[model samples]
Target: MAAYYSQNNPDPSPTSLTFAYPQTMDWNRELLRNEPGMLAEEKLSDVERLKVKIRMFARFIGMKGAETPRWEYERGVEILARRIERRVRLEEETEMRRKVFMGPRAWQA
Candidate 1:
């Protein structure tokens, strides 16, 4: 674990390490791969939230132009959202069919 400073330091360094924004699409893809169960809206919300954090980090590092366009960010999110919606619909349909086929038997222990 890393310890954090309680307050801002009085002295600032002219030479500090900074990193540029890596490809956000790569980040989006990796996030999706890691969280297969995330709902579509949750994924989109997470992406937006992460974008804000990335922007703040860029500013803290004294860098400019780290923000990607809104459309670029939404493109990947929308694609995943569609897939999630389709999956949910399919699951609901499957459950409905199972209930219908099982009828009264489904209620038995």
Candidate 2:
């Protein structure tokens, strides 16, 4: 048992571990500085929210070592936004056609 312990536990003293921590005052100052901006996200429109999400996703993908260029992601987001707009337009047109077919009663319904 002693031989096994000596072989496996040669320097069993607890090692001093150093952790880097930001000064508490600096951390609190930075958090206070950005607090209002964090709250502003709740006021963004649907499209703006989507754009923000896409931008965050692009950043995450870039961090993951993706070879795709930034412009490509931006272009793709623009194309997606245009498609969404077109779809909304078509839906509005369809609703208008239904209203016309259903006569003035459609408005009451």
Question: In each prediction, how many residue pairs overlap at the backbone (N, C-alpha, C within less than 3 A)?
Answer: 0, 0
lDDT tens per residue, model 1, 24-79:
43443533443767555545456665765676568656698866667646755676
For model 2, the stretches where C-alpha displacement exceeds 4 angstroms are: 1-66, 102-109
Q: What would the TM-scores of all predictions be?
A: 0.38, 0.33
lDDT of each: 0.57, 0.49
lDDT of 2 by residue, 10-52 (tens): 5666233222221132323221223443433223344644554
Worst 10 residues of 2 by lDDT: 18-27
Candidate 2: residue pairs that collide: none
Give the candidate number with the greatest TM-score: 1
C-alpha root-mean-square deviation, candidate 2: 16.8
- Ten-residue stretch with the least lDDT total in model 1: 14-23
